[model samples]
Target: MAKKPKSDPNYKVIAENRRARHDYAIDEDLEVGIVLMGSEVKSLREGGANIAESYAAVEEGELWLVNGRIAPYAQAKTWGHEERRKRKLLASKRELARLWNATQRKGMTLVPLVLYFNHKGLAKMKIGIAKGKKHHDKRADAAKQDWNRQKARLLRDKG
Candidate 1:
């Protein structure tokens, strides 16, 4: 999870894919830089972005963020960026190789988890290496959560 720093004004989440965790079992997550245009950055600063339907992919030896949407900046009408363009994600060569191997050989997915600006105000994204969860898995998770809640309530009442 992306932790927001209490004292940093620039540390803000632009967009988050809340359903990613519910649909996928994340093995690991990595933060990587995103290549954004000026207009896209402006839009993101205004909280005009969505990662709900976005994903990451290691393509042709490079990482790409696909289907991410950054609403066009109204002020940059002449030079606005495409809302749903494929953006390049920057990561170390070693990390890229590992991600590629996980996706290709291990059959894992690269799911976009969160899009945010770091403490220094640079835009970054968290990508999760995950496997898809089945319907039964979701149900079991819900049941477990319910049981925990009930157990907590019972202990509280007994005390």
Candidate 2:
């Protein structure tokens, strides 16, 4: 995970699906707005959320985030939201159409990459259009990464 710069107080990462990149070959990603209740927002600000097992989908001509968990805020007893309810994602009509086409026609999956508050303090999520990686592909990628790491170490030692 990339560290958030200390200078930016508003930018905070609440959750990240780190395994998404290892399991899927991401083609592209987009930042989208999320609809959240007051309690949900408060919970997120406390950094209590999980996106590792969640994913995004385009259904009924709209985008939705499924399986994401936001822990309930303790103070808001009556207003607390469901921990694992489906949340609506906001995107332009054209982007929605493109995402639908990618999933239906191109055989791609919409994976939630990261969930965070942007610089403006609004909750946003980054979703990637990706295709599943086969076992052999994953192995090859791991081998390539290992080689790159060793090569960099050797170069540093030589210089």
Candidate 3:
């Protein structure tokens, strides 16, 4: 008989940069596919990733994801591709146009929220359309988050 897969005690956190939430006011999010090199894809599957400094840009009618890093595969040789080269992203024509329009607005930005494998075992990126937060806005968000945390803690204690 075939053996079943073992459950991990801890949920695997492939990778994440928590700063994205604190830096921008996300307006919307879309899950998109990325074009990757051989080594890059292997690195991503191994949970070798970094997205803190990554963002999306559109140029010449093509969408690109820049600043995202997937480490080189261990067995890869000197011919390995660039670690943080701008990678192409796939989206529908309408979606791409909408994103382009939103990006033209001042202070509006495209930020990568998360990178993970989907049910089909393909890598996907969740990109968020966000607006930059001003100093006052940041302070307000921080305060709100603090209040929420306190509320949760108090409720837990009472329970």
Candidate 4:
């Protein structure tokens, strides 16, 4: 039998932390399942999630996503989930151990890059192992991006 492709058309992105790339130098990334309540899932499907201030932490040999906000479902008045609850992330024991070890290094942290529903309709979080960028590093990166854009525009005009 032929192997199947990894990406499927059914997958849909719920929210992305675009600032993650600007604020941190991402080293590695992995997708992990997120534990969410029914109302939270519904809210996410309606495009209501904010991972801007969220980070992942390993505690008691398990990974947990912290500070992520999943807005309450509009129709879930009495049964709405908390907006900023810590959600558990599902990963293999080995993967969890590796992440824990990497986080032990100075200035290294786990940042949630994006939140999306998989092809199977299950909520997942793409977490990255990143180091926070310094003020100068951020400025340099912005300069490089500006230069790249300018170069692209110049080439397009010349062509």
Q: Rate the local accuracy (lDDT) of all candidates.
A: 0.94, 0.93, 0.82, 0.90
Tens-digit lDDT track of model 3 for 1-159 = 011235533223345656877899889988888898888877877888998998899889988999888888887787677888999999999999999999999999898887766655677777899998889999998899999999999999999
Candidate 2 differs from the real structure by a C-alpha RMSD in angstroms, to one decimal, of 1.3
Whole-structure CA lDDT of model 4: 0.90
Tell me the tens digit of each residue's lDDT in model 4 across 95-135: 99999999999999999998988778889889999999999
User: Residue by residue across 43-148, what tens digits does model 2's lDDT show?
Assistant: 9999999999999999999999999999999999977799999999999999999999999855599999999998899999999999999999999999999999
Estimate the overall C-alpha local distance difference test score of candidate 2.
Answer: 0.93
Of candidates 2 and 1, the better by lDDT:
1
Instruction: Evaluate model 4: give its TM-score.
Output: 0.90
lDDT of 3 at 151: 100
Candidate with the larger TM-score of 3 and 4 = 4
Superior by lDDT: candidate 1 or candidate 4:
1
Candidates, ranked, lDDT? 1, 2, 4, 3
TM for every model, in the order presented, reads: 0.97, 0.96, 0.85, 0.90
Superposed on all Cα atoms, the candidates' RMSDs to the truth, in angstroms, are 1.0, 1.3, 5.5, 4.1
